[model samples]
Target: MTTTVRIATPDEVPILNAIRTSVRENHMTLEQMADYGITPEVIANLLRTTGRAFIANVDGVDAGISIADSAEGNIFAMFVLPDYEGLGLGRLLLAHAEAFLHATGVASAWLEAGAGPGIRAHGFYAHLGWQSDGLMPDGQLRFVKSRAALTQIVAGG
Candidate 1:
């Protein structure tokens, strides 16, 4: 499935919001998302400010999305549609985000994932060699990865 990852424009905020809202696992309702500051307006502002939002298209369809905060070295968000899961789109999006961070002179990156039921991101991050740094104040699991390590992994060490 020819997957392409590209930086997103402000106009694609709605599409990015749709991909984020469509997550079946670690699901968050619109109200819950708003509580966590995940509204479309917030996302649009993020895209405008950082220009780090990326969309992954599979066979000409939006399959996943990722957003990185280069200044903070944070993988702020990443989500893949349920139907697109297990096809490696999520990993692809993550790599794209990490690469962006690296290019921006970030040596390390971190992200928070849900710790509640139906959350499977811990395993995914671990499998990708991210180090666990325990839970955040918000009760989300924190994972960190170094750009040098990722480069080694990608180059087959």
Candidate 2:
């Protein structure tokens, strides 16, 4: 029940890959992931760029992961193991991503989610105050949220 989130180091790619591939929705197989340039080296290189990766643990067990890119102002990725779904780890990880963007002086951040009907991510982003701007050419739903407004909400405005 003890939940914690931390900056993920380069050596933890397996943990990242584990949480990522565990998702039944929007999953990429090992080959597919590498095909998309999502290799361990890329993950490490990304962390050295205008982005960061995070790992969330429940009772000391890795359960989720997220990556936020301040340069792109994007929540590049987020995933949680199915068994960890109901524990609110996704929310915690997302907040870390947003905070990373805000702290880097980004005014807003955006992320892509599966646009298909009945996809929980669409509603999840909306429920978190991310406005659905439009559907992207990639057929993913684009969701945006301004850090200023988010700060206000956190401040009890």
- TM per candidate comes to 0.88, 0.91
Per model, state how many residue pairs clash: 0, 0
Best by the lDDT measure: 2
TM-score of 2: 0.91
Find the 10 residues in a row with the least total lDDT in model 1.
148-157
Task: List model 1 lDDT by residue over 50-129, tens digit each.
Answer: 64887989899998988888778899989999998999988888887877777777778899998775578989989988
Q: In candidate 2, which residue ranges exceed 4 Å CA deviation?
A: 151-157
Per-residue lDDT, model 2, residue 54, is: 86
- Can you write out model 2's per-residue Cα lDDT over 43-157, one digit (the tens) per residue? 8888887778889989989999889888888999999998889789888888778877777878888999976888999888888899998989978899999878443212100
Q: In angstroms, how far off is 112's CA in candidate 1?
A: 0.6
